[model samples]
Target: MHKNFTHILTSLVVVIAITSCDIGDNKDVNPASSFLKIYDSHQFDHAIGPVDVVQTDTEGYLLLGNYRRDDTNFLGTYIASVDSRGEFIRNTYVQGSNVHPVGKFLLLGGQRYFVSMDAVGLQGYLNQVDDSARVVSTIALGVTYPMYAENDGTDQFILLSYNSVDATTVLSLVSADGSIANQSAFGIGAGQSVEEPIIDHFTRTGRELPFFAGRASSGLYYLNGFYNYTLSLLFSDLSDNNPTGVVQGQQDEGGVSGLLSLDGGQFAVSRFNFGDSYTNALATLNASGTTSSNDIQSNPMLEWEVDAKVKMISLTLDGVGYVVIGTTTKNQQIVLHFYDQTTGNYVAVDYLGFSSPYQLGAIEVTADNGLAILGSIQVAGKFQRLCLFKVSEGELLDLVQ
Candidate 1:
């Protein structure tokens, strides 16, 4: 399953385009019949990409992340606001040269926060933008990638920073106005960083933890390390380190490079098992930083053991639970998992697969009640055209149709 890492690197680039969206969740309906392409760019110029889409509470979506003009090029942070119909309302680009942020734009309360991990020296800034993609406020966190931003549920933001040099992690509480209220670091020389650290969910009380899934000292096997909310250390023993528990489990866990939080105190760490053998396992966390004691506790959620290598996973649990999974398959085939929020189970839906491969770069669910898919399409076998897929509640339900 070892691929030419060099070639697969192109999957990291995201391109953008706009189109009209039809509303409706009837699974038996044809999504394309009412699907319109609002913004489509055959090239990356004047085009923003590597975009992370988030829906606002007002039914508008904020497309946040960074975009590059070309290979080895860096684009500053970007936040584009789109209506529920997937039409662009406004787009804003942050002021930075080499600051290419690498994680998804996080939404807390009514504000949108994105970190500039690609910026050197200073960590990055947390941004607050309005529905029109205007920067409301910005706060700086020293040297942290995949910064975990969450609202304490009371107009407060809990920001976590991971310091690879000291092998330590820190947590801070910033007010809604982008001011730091409290800060603390738990681990000193415990957390390991392989290139960068990945932070997951935070509680309304300003608690968060980092989930590690990098290689072990052996350099042959993989390891999973869990850090506490206060950035304290936990899960030290490698005895139970096997991601799937069975140490020699046939499934390869090395490709799992990121972690994400699910609503109701659950977090799913994604691992690319290489090739079509990709698997995402759900881990339930307790207030004390321990995971549920279930072997493969929940369903694998996604099991694409054929042609797709899942690259990014987006979860929306506020309303009806839905998952948008992006992949590296040449066909650009994306899988949407819809579940009953109350039951934490899939809602028995069917999605018609697109015949040709489409490169799905990044997918985000906005607070405005819509979903945005950003990526490039190969036209006539030579054009890397930017394309977007917008789905409403009804349009989502129409997938099964």
Candidate 2:
């Protein structure tokens, strides 16, 4: 599919109200932006939405997530549907087996789909869910131990997995019917060391290690993950699933924390080493056959710094271009800084989650040209629950100006 840089962004979504949460011991409400309300999830002990959310044809939403039953390592799959106002309607859960779920929901042929592991056999599961928050069918995948997934904006999805026994990283192109179109593997030098972290991805700061796979605007298939013992952005040849060039990194500098491939082959790249993380809003991708972490760090276009997760996305709004950067700060806040897409000049900034702590997860440009943000809120300053915030077009324009 041709990359639509002008289209709307959507994903796993839940919005908040100005009400106190029933699950927490402390009732802290974020009144920072009247338009920014954190949704309450009272049923689940813990709910995290690193998954995908899509707006239904009705202008409502279908959100997918991972929920822990009782603070265990295992996380069950949870699904919910909400109205256009971000009000909740219905939801369901698929109990966990071993590891946390990965990947966003894929919208294929007007149907909603997602790929993860089946709890019982621990096999890959291609699930088809209805807009009404129902899992209609699930096809078991031959590709096991799945890690991350992303749609090529066309028909197929980029699936990232691991071969624990072989100590290799697996990459596959999966069709809508749950069939593998093309697959490849590369050795992970220290196999057990890499595999152990993936198993613990859900429980810990899953943010430390980021997995990205997508088709860039330059018509290149690229994946940023473990390859040959290191985390590198491996750009592939057009025909085969093989790296033509690589933008490699060291384990010491924390590898690529967030990557958003922009037009003209450039990208909004962010990296984290230990506690500090920073982003280069306007950076190119032609890594010299062997680029390293030092090369990315030498970039002078530093946009912002944070001690937590940093994410970015590019969008063209009403004739103007923007590279929006969202950062989770060490100070218990989520800050959004917008920059001029063409010049990389700073435009505006907004803050969320004042009283209670928040960690940024996902962001989207809603169908109405508004903004949809996904974040995990510490309810009562302790219980972690998923929350979504939508900024109206009027509010967005005010910030842009």
Candidate 3:
């Protein structure tokens, strides 16, 4: 439940005529003009990448990511607020050993919270911040790789994490004030490990259903204690902690990087295959957690041997399609692929880069039918700084036409 940051510019006027430049192919497209603004983190020597972005009720934007003090092992989590015009309002950092923010902004009971993990990934903290980006409280949690968190439309939310010790998937129903209410664990069989659980809810038959996807060991037992890897999907009722269905992919080894709910028991997932060479694929699933369409590989845009990896995937607010973001192994440039959810067809692809390689972290549809992409841009061949791109909805649709 990574909150969409597209709502941040609700107060800003949408200018359909703004011109933009595509980094790859140097083509001039109409939607390219919709590139609104870009923000950079000047405080740190290197801003790793944005983990999440959210638009506040007051029309401001909150960003969560990591920053490095230098080219050393010192990594810190950062939270910042920006005005509707992409102007920085306030910025703060939680200094820790190799800290990386996980999940997105959580607005519950009229408060804002952001989650992150430490170097070892075993310990993490949820920071409560105000509109001014000031930390109000920090609640610690014992979890590694905090994958996803979704509210139950009440005072509680279900958090997905990985238990590094036992290699089990952990699900916890926690209160809005950062207190655990109930918890459950799912073991994917002995010698099999699970990681990167992404969760979302979709309305089907007048009821909202919660679904999750992640990577798990293929369960192909080896002589000692080895197992192949594959992607997994499951449908769960967070209220009672009951899992109704589970689905696993046929790929030899891969992990789900992004997930989006398309409603009516349908959703899309972005997966990275690590079986032989690095490849990416997109698939759609039905209510039963089963694949509804064939695996759509990166071959549509790049060859299978190009080594493309999808880092994030997000649905358009309209739920008609989704956008996939990642980096190409050769150029290391950030690449974005847009697809129609209904036909599962590729609409367009865009690349972004500065002087050095760009790493895309997160993307969300805006209130005005645009997209807000969060990532890091290398500056002067030295520092990697946080960067945000605002693309208008008109620009997005133009590419399809």
The lDDT for every candidate, in the order shown, is 0.44, 0.66, 0.51
Q: Rank the candidates by lDDT, best first.
A: 2, 3, 1
Each model's total of backbone clashes: 36, 6, 6
Worst 10 residues of 3 by lDDT: 219-228
Stretches of candidate 3 off by over 4 Å are: 1-44, 68-74, 96-98, 118-121, 142-145, 151-154, 188-231, 238-252, 275-330
The better-scoring model by lDDT among 1 and 2 is 2
**TM-score of candidate 1 to 2 decimals:** 0.59
Superposition error at 1 for model 3 (Å):
43
Point out where model 1 deviates above 4 Å.
Answer: 1-48, 56-58, 69-75, 102-110, 177-330, 339-356, 359-386, 398-401
Which candidate comes out best when scored by lDDT? Answer: 2
Candidate RMSDs in Å, in order, are 10.4, 8.8, 10.7
Reference-based lDDT, residue 205, model 1: 20
lDDT of 3 by residue, 1-401 (tens): 11222232211112211232332232453433244344544343344556677766776578777665543232467777876555678787665453555655777787888765555444656777887777788777766656566545456655776655666556776776667876655554444222222211110112111123332122110010111233455554433433444445543244333455543434445544443232233443433344411243434334222323344455564446554545444556666766665655666777665445566666656666666777765544445556667666655655655
Count of backbone collisions in candidate 1: 36
- Per-residue lDDT of 339 in model 2: 82
